[model samples]
Target: MSEEEWIVDGIDHLNYRAVEGVYLSELNVGLKKLILHDYPELSDSSFVSNVHLVKYRLIFMKNVIDKANKKNDYVRETVYEVTKNQAYETMDVQEEWDNTITFGQKIADIVARFGGSWTFIISFVFLMAVWMAFNVLKPFGLVFDAYPFILLNLALSTLAAIQAPLIMMSQNRSSDYDRLQAKNDYRVN
Candidate 1:
């Protein structure tokens, strides 16, 4: 091409021409918008040389453009697709999952919280102390559960059976949430 034909004006009103076989002025408007969106600091300032902008766009937006092209999406305007993908990727999956949790899951979380607290421990200790004291101090014929405390044993065993599963369910949910967070972080990075 002639030198005059090679020189063209960029979106920022700066003149650019073929540099190392890359033509900045020939870039698609959508790609220009994507470059601007990716680098807000470059949006307002005119680049001293077109070489830097061309190199940056090629290095940074190549993957995004290729992915958009592969999906056959944003063929006319890649900025929209890129922005939409970024928004979706950065969304809080944990909050969305928490919102979708079932009533059973909420109950399991509550049970797990209460089971791990000092209040449960203190109240259980107090109840056992009172039970032992009453049974030991009362007359022999009036004692309902003797020193063996079979009723207490059965109740404790049932509580353990129910509590173990609830705690495990909550832990599984916590692990799932952590995994989701890691996935989001990986995507964002």
Candidate 2:
């Protein structure tokens, strides 16, 4: 767009305006980033700016294809066709769909992956049972803890208070690792 933005040595060396009638995929990498900024202009009536960006990309890709066609024409042609058929609208739609699917799948995945963690549940149940058993069996002389057992109560309360957070810490670390694995797996494909 500005004279200062032009590059002649790398991608900046090629004059995009020199091939104004080309398609989108042929454009060079630098020009591609430049053109990506004008995606919103596709809806305009004239479409001159949008067309120019697409043409630059098309030209760049075509140049690469020309050099490599003799050794692998089929691959080059396929690449060219795929590139040409892709437009800003198609890319935008794919991006939106990817975002939606990612969010939805993350929710489902988290639930399905670690939702049944039993440690927390078991600890909670055990803690409650300890309290109840102590109260219920007091008259039976199962006196591991006796009436007004302040020391026993203190020990139970302290263990519960400390152990709950430790269990939570372990759960959190595993969950974090699982999430990291999921993210890496998604990216690899």
**TM-score of every candidate:** 0.52, 0.27
lDDT of 1 by residue, 1-189 (tens): 544434333334456553423343345666556666655544333332455566656765787778878777545467565567555545779678888899999999999999999999999899989888878888665787887888889988999999999999999988988888888787775
Quote the lDDT for 179 in model 2. 69
Taken over the whole model, the C-alpha lDDT of each candidate is 0.70, 0.53
Off by over 4 Å in 2: 1-145
lDDT of 1: 0.70
Question: What lDDT does candidate 2 reach at residue 139?
Answer: 57
How high is the lDDT of residue 30 in model 1? Answer: 63
- Pick the TM-score winner: 1
For model 1, state the Cα shift of residue 80 in Å. Answer: 13
Error of 2 at 131 (Å): 9.6
